[model samples]
Target chain A: MFECLFEQASLLKKICEAIKELTDQACFEVSGTGISLQAMDSSHVSLVSFLLRNEHFSQFRCDRNLTLGLNLKMITKILKTAGNEDRVTLRAEDDGDHLVMVIESKTGNKISSYEVKMLDIDQQAFGVNETDYKASTKMSSEEFQRICHDLLVVGDTVSIEMTKDGITFSVSGTETSGCITCRQSGTVDDESVGTEITLQEPMNLSFALKFLNLFTKATPLSNSVSIEMSADQPLCIHYDIGDMGNIRYFLAPKIDDEEGAGAAGAPAAAPTEAAGGDDE
Target chain B: MGIKHLMQVILENAPDAVVENPVPSYFGRVIGIDASMALYQFLIAVRVEGQQLTNDKGEVTSHLMGMFTRTTKMMAAGLRPVYVFDGRPPEAKQNELARRHEVREDAKEKEAEAKEAGDQAEMERFSRRQVRVNQQHCDEAKRLLTLMGIPYIEAPGEAEAQCAALCRAGKIWATGSEDMDSLCFGSPILLRNLTFSEARKLPIREVHLDQVIAGLGLTMPQFVDFCILCGCDYCGTIKGIGEKNALKLIKRWGTIEQALEHLDKTKFPLPESFNYQQARALFQQPEVLDPARVDLRWGQPDEEGLVQFLVGEKQFAEDRVRATTARLRASKQTATQSRLEQFMGPPAIMTSCSAPPGPWPMVQGPIVLTPSPFPPLRQQAGAAAAEKGNKKARTSAKGAKGAAKATATKPAAKKR
Candidate 1:
């Protein structure tokens, strides 16, 4: 049995907020350590991994470690229905196929239990290897988040480039493609920051800005956000979740025009959306 | 202008004129002007005669007159100005610049088209009212700075940031600009009123760079975060978040990271990967060091040349120009005499300008000054002269390649 209560229901809102970026469905494995979910986003550009440590829970009980696969949309709906004073309980039923989530309050009580189904998702076995990246920057989560919001109007894909001088965030497209770029020249104040990590390799990578925009939602949890990447390697974005735990999102670089489809190792339609979404 | 008259003019020409607090001192230093937004204010304040000024060749001279007058006034105030001539903008900003360029180009094109279409009246109106700063105007400003003995630094990228850096390094006291971004770049002073009379009347306000962050209830890092949130040249800020909301959110969250986390979970609309930290670092970084240093000195004034340029060429009122020149010459004389006394002092021989002397006896005269009070000048003068002659030899001896040879012989010479 796992139960948590907050005067404000927004705490649970954040947990679901991060998951929605990675995949529509998530399988959370609850153990003595707490709840953990690891999955790649739909575009496969990034992997989202989350862990809520046992110590952060108000009340935690687990007889054995159990993996529960649940749909993100369903969980979001349940969280949306939750009232500020409602007590939320999440428990795995005796029956292996079901999980029970109950929200109770003076107004009424709502009990919802979802059937667990094993999804045959073809997981890519990508190794995480460290590389020498030219520059690393720490930004306020709010600022980073704001950039992502702006990108929604600019384009779906954003490119990040890091040189010896500084890091740049840009987007480009043809008559069919538009781009935005942000560059920081190496200056004195940035050099004095002990937290910066810079190597010798200039890196350029493109990824769907939408995922980044959603991934940055976790920024409010910490003051500093760290980004690590290499020229042809996957970019790693790490968020500090305080005592609760950390959430890491790793994104694979998109293929360039010259490299063609061979680099991606899979043939698929290029991701482009019609301009129908609300500006906000 | 009287308030009633000003209000009437504003009501009639509201679209053409804008009024705001005078530019701050730090921003003024960056734009290389003592008066913040002075040129723009001047353009708005003075009413131009409908009759156009013409050269001997009968070419329109209004633009040149306006540019030259504004640039000369800026130079006399000791502001170093770099006039940026517009070029083909980078692809990213091209859309925005092109949009503006189109408006100007369209007016020109429309006038020509109107004349072709036999609408002579429309063509005449467009020709009469058009105002612009062209490449020729930029070149003229540069030439004027060169002749006036004021330094002009050409910008490789954004002219405003380069100008701000000049002020930041104390190369200049302030920048004169109409844009508010100078505040974001941490300029120490800005001045808004630029005309000769207005500038003299209004005292320039010095903006403590750090105070902006403090006033906004943020740290230096958070301030950068706040600016990024407010929107920047490189990127646009989130919707529904203006300057006030941006500051409030940053203050509440303390840092960009915390803000992102809170935003991520909260029902409040938030953008992903906002990276406020990165954006802050970009604008808040310290200004680059200037390779060329400032050497403040006192020298003879070219009174005849200055008088000819200001009175004969520019047609300025002679008395006003003479009064300003007199003040400049007096200040220059006081500075020179003080330096001469320092040169006579013994301590001055040992110390470079980097290390200034401690408090010395104040010399009270028509002009208050500090005398060079060093006592060892006569004794050290001869040795210092000889040392100066062998300066190159001494430096070569201390070179890295010579270190091994010197160290190798030390012990052998000791044993002997």
Candidate 2:
């Protein structure tokens, strides 16, 4: 049997929101360490990895390591029943086919229980090793989310260009163009509104804006976001889930249809050589 | 692509996704209907002599005949149908509309050609394709529904979308449409083939969106994506990715983009300018306005207005129109009795009549003073058994009047 309890219901709620945006069904691996999920989305354009340590919970117990294949949407629905001030308890037998969730009111007198059938999801784990990311940027997640949303109306692809000066998110269409440039600042009046960038070399790539926007689902899990990228490699977005764990998203860059510059919205601040491919 | 492929995909992916041939329990329930689709089907199937049914002024009466009979049947079966009419078409649907127009035009040309060649079968087939539900058709249908005491709503967009919205809002029990698109529009319950003849032994399919989601082990969004992969009118699909392939890919990959990546690019080449995003958005958040504000009133049928509009203007057969109205009245009465039985208890047998005594009652000899055991008091009780019994009592009264002559001399002695 496995059981875990949370003092605040919002932690699990945030985790569900972060996972459901990427995939509908996921295999959750539970161990003495905690709960962790790593799976590439069906489309293979993005990958979402989530981890929550056992110590983070108010109470945690596990008899053996188990893999629970769950329909994220169903569990998400169950989680939705929990109020912010409510205490949530998750329970499952070692060989049980269903997961039981009990939500209690602040007074602990009223409680509601939901039992969801679990699935036998055939999972093939895809692991990633540490990579040497050429450039990394730490910015307010809300700012990053807004930039992605605004650029979505302009075009389908966003060109992310990082330099010693700053990082720019740009998109261009036939009738409109949008770009948001954030530079590292030593001091700012508002603590939350700031960007810090560290670059080894200038790197540029184009990625689908929709996927980027989806990555913002992790925003509620963290106040600030860290972005690490390398040329010709997938972009990694990291979110720290307070004491619980961290959620990371890796999005692959769009390659070689030769329409990058036009679809990326002019790339106004890019060096002249970056526009050479489109000219031919 | 049509949603037919989506159904096929569901069959292949989750063979038990749809539970077919199930009876719908529509008792005391309200069903929202796609009125335009119904009218189109009626016009196509109810044709006589391979020609559309028209009145004296050459106005189409087919919609009227079908709706009148169908609505009456629904009412008799205890299902309240609220016909929803389509308003302006969405901009995304312009291409589909244009394509339909082209097909209709071609069918018209073929119909004329077949007529010239004296091919009856070809002409009939082509003629069915030429049936169009125009503004006049919709207006006349609404009028007929109004006259039949059925409620209808003029939707601002696709009638199915509005019907789905009504279903979601709990204003109606289910949405009645021929297509599965209502499921994509997020209708909680969708009833298919509602217009089919009720005599068929096979039960109508009632689809619950949640059950479908559970059966397929997919979220609502994933199902919508699967439908798009199978192809939809709003966007193009990758070539060579048919129903089975699309379902398998989605099951394996979990999204269209991932499915595309796993697919053999050489075989299934993605289309240029493919905009699944817009399609997904449309299915996720369709442009359906709030349905609660619409006043849904089932008013009394305007008998005189119906006769004027259907008989006077449209030239429907006068006798048939009158017969329909009479039948409607009879059915309404029966329906009310059934409703009363359900809510309260079965009505008690009554020996009283509300009809006032005629002037000849005094001359007929004290028959009006004693209450008659027969219930019918007017010629309006066509089907009431009490009326038949009352007729016998009236016939026997004539004999009693003759007998009164002999008893008249002793009337002063028989006063007590």
Residue A171 alpha-carbon offset, candidate 2, angstroms: 76
What is every candidate's C-alpha DockQ against the true complex, given to 2 decimals? Answer: 0.01, 0.00
Judged by DockQ cut-offs, the docking class of candidate 1 is incorrect
Per-residue alpha-carbon lDDT of model 1 for B1-416, expressed as tens digits? 00112223222323222323332221222245422133333333333453455445554444334444544444344333444222232333443455556776778988898889988678766654344445544444434333333344444344445456667666655555544556566666544344434534654433444544544446666666666676654444566776666667788987667776776444456555444454455466523324144221212334565566545655546786566555543322211101111111111111111122222111223121122121112112223324444232222212222221121111110000
Every model's TM-score: 0.35, 0.47
lDDT: worst 10-residue window of model 1 chain B: B407-416
lDDT of 2 by residue, A111-202 (tens): 99998787745443332434678999888899999999889999777889988888999887646878888988744766675788878888
Give the poorly placed runs of model 2, Cα more than 4 Å off: A1-280, B10-25, B198-202, B330-416
iRMSD value for model 1: 36.5
lDDT of 1 by residue, A1-280 (tens): 3333333355666778777856787656454445555666533446676665554555555543344556777777777877756656676632244556666663555544433343322222122333444556665566677777776676656777776555567765323444434344233363332234465667776766767887887876666667777655567787777756667776655443321223233211111121121111
lDDT of 2 by residue, B1-416 (tens): 24646555555555544645433335445788888888987887666786778987787888877887777777665466788877777666666678889999999999999999999999899988878888778777766776666667777667778888888788898988877787887888877777765555556667778767777778888888888877776777788877666667778889887876677878767788578888787777766657767545444455677788778877877787777776654434322111212211221211101112122111222323323211111111222213233232212222322322221210110010
